[model samples]
Target: MTLGEILAVAAVGISALTLWDSHQERVRTEEKAVATADRADAEAAVLVLRATPSRDGDRLTLAPLNPEQAIQAQTILFPSALKLPPVETTGDPRIEADWFAEPLKRARKGAGQKDEDPGDQRLPIIVVTHYLAGGARHTSRAIHDLGYTLEGRFLRGSAVTLRGMSIVRTVKEEGAQAALDAVWTGRHRSAG
Candidate 1:
């Protein structure tokens, strides 16, 4: 080939190699972003799944649904609005009457006066659970709704029940401690 043709061929080859390198770099960057997002989603899911609450009668306990994950500590904080104390335990904790029964009764009474259904009353409580999984410590916050049923003649007997529970979010150790402090200090604020 002539000198000009040879030079053109070399330029084309260099351009092709540079294009390939740029394409590969873009692909790698995309893959990394996808992997990071997937990891975050998985961690959130783990927090949600591990903070499941189990209730028996007037008692409640939080444990991981998967046996592999074990809870290190758990705290149940009645809303500051409810004016109830926080309970800390490593075992199943009894649902206190003040935590739900009294507030529910009051709500029911208020609803009755307003011509609303007493059965629609609900009390929300925050639960924090600490667990170690995959060599990392995870703290999760779950909001549980407490309901009550009035039974017997004239609805004299009242029993507290667990209406529902949901994992709202996960926090760092410091944030979790701050939440506990907020509740224990009797501050009227959102813990999580």
Candidate 2:
């Protein structure tokens, strides 16, 4: 073939190579995004502590602080396998409570202790999983609500790609009185 024909063939070959590279890059980007999303679905749990200050009885709720609008998944309440220490209602500010005991609970279930003795009295753990607006089964926050308040740190995820925040601490709950008081009076809490 002539030099011109050779140059034309070279140009076509280069264009084809470039297109293939572009396609590979696109595929890699898509894979990265999917992996990131999967990681996000298994995102860390949030710890929330809520209480109602009232004369009747101060009801406290411990749970994961997820989006308020997020829908709740089927909550599974598995009794603690190992004996979790009772809530120490004491003078000291910090009380000892099990922080995120889901894994422990699962391990216990895996073992045949509970199968042998089902009647055993174990403190039930309320595990509530919340789904984000995207409808992905995001996180399963296990709150072992005792008198002790959770203490830890949660680092928020990046702002560019909004995902679940990593809850370093361990809780969520709503006050019954607060809801009722708002519904009835539509005003502030009555000062005692």
Candidate 3:
């Protein structure tokens, strides 16, 4: 081929390569955007779990914080339509499962004491294990401190299988005490 034809061929090859590289970069950028959106969605779901109380006080409520997230979380956390109880959080690390389930004053005094009334409507924790089918372990830990929210109900039931408890990661910017103080002191709620 002549010199001009050779140069034209070379130019075409270079142009094709540049276009291919640009397309690859665009694909990567799109993938990154999708991944970022997924992370944001997961974070929002986690926030709902941390900030809101249950609706029926028996089934987990994602209300008042972000309703759409709460509904989505309910589907994500309990897909089988299992009944999960409401949770009450406290900064006191000493508070475990029993007293939350039943008052200390109601402890059994004599032998052969039966469990408290199930109809009492107290909050029962519904646990989600770290070992899920997919990559949920990563998202779950990102939201909470990676402990069960309720104390003892991790692995006692026939239907439920739990390995560890997960708790909400207290906002360290304000300290653990302040986040909880807002809840009990009613500062988190608006004055209506």
Candidate 4:
């Protein structure tokens, strides 16, 4: 080929190389983004567990000793269904299954203890907290969107029981914990 033709061919080859490199970089960037999202999901879950209360009335807030139930509750409480993203951060996702489940379940057991009279039996309530994953901005947004206007900076989930009546708290973690604690402590007893 002539000198001019060779030069033209070389330019085209160089341009192709540049485009390929750019494409590869884009792919790497996308993958990194996806991995980051997954990490955020896991971290958010852990933070919530850490913030959860250790005791709920008569319930010691024991860990969910049942492996199956603990796993299920972790799924239910963390990575919460709320529209908000994680406020805290984590490298790997881990759940405090036993810590979160045991106490609330224990409180339930305590409430069930046969007492003096039918009217005297009191139910128990349990509250759970989750520290947000991701940055403060993300955590704030998640908390606000989730509707947790509490003093602590975390995600909250709760379940309460009164005799056979049961209620699950989705948005108000602190209030739920307080209410649950009151029942467990006998501060609030139902009139039979």
Candidate 2: stretches off by over 4 Å? 44-57, 68-133, 137-145, 148-192
Candidate 4, superposed: residue stretches over 4 Å from native: 1-4, 45-124, 128-132, 137-192
lDDT of 2 at 84: 34
Best by lDDT: 1
Candidate 3 lDDT, 1-192, residue by residue in tens: 999999999999999999999999999999999999887666554532432223322222222233433221221221111222323332211223332333211222122223432322121123221221123332222223212222234466211111222343434423433343333223112210
Ranking by TM-score: 1, 2, 3, 4
* Candidate 4 residue lDDT tens string, 1-192: 999999999999999999999999999999999999887665544422222222422122223221222221222232211112222223322323332333433433344532223342322323232222343221111121111111211354333222121233333544543343443355223211
In model 1, residue pairs whose N, Cα or C atoms come closer than 3 Å (at least 3 residues apart or on different chains), thus clashing, are none
Model 3 lDDT vs. the true structure?
Answer: 0.34
Tens digits of lDDT, candidate 1, 8-114: 99999999999999999999999999999788656644754333223533444445665556577777776444445677766553344445566545543543422
TM-score of each: 0.51, 0.40, 0.34, 0.31
Residue 124, model 1, lDDT: 55
Each candidate: what lDDT? 0.55, 0.37, 0.34, 0.35
> Which candidate do you rate higher for lDDT, 1 or 3?
1
Each prediction's RMSD to truth:
7.2, 18.6, 14.3, 14.6
Best by TM-score: 1
Model 3 poorest ten-residue lDDT run: 72-81
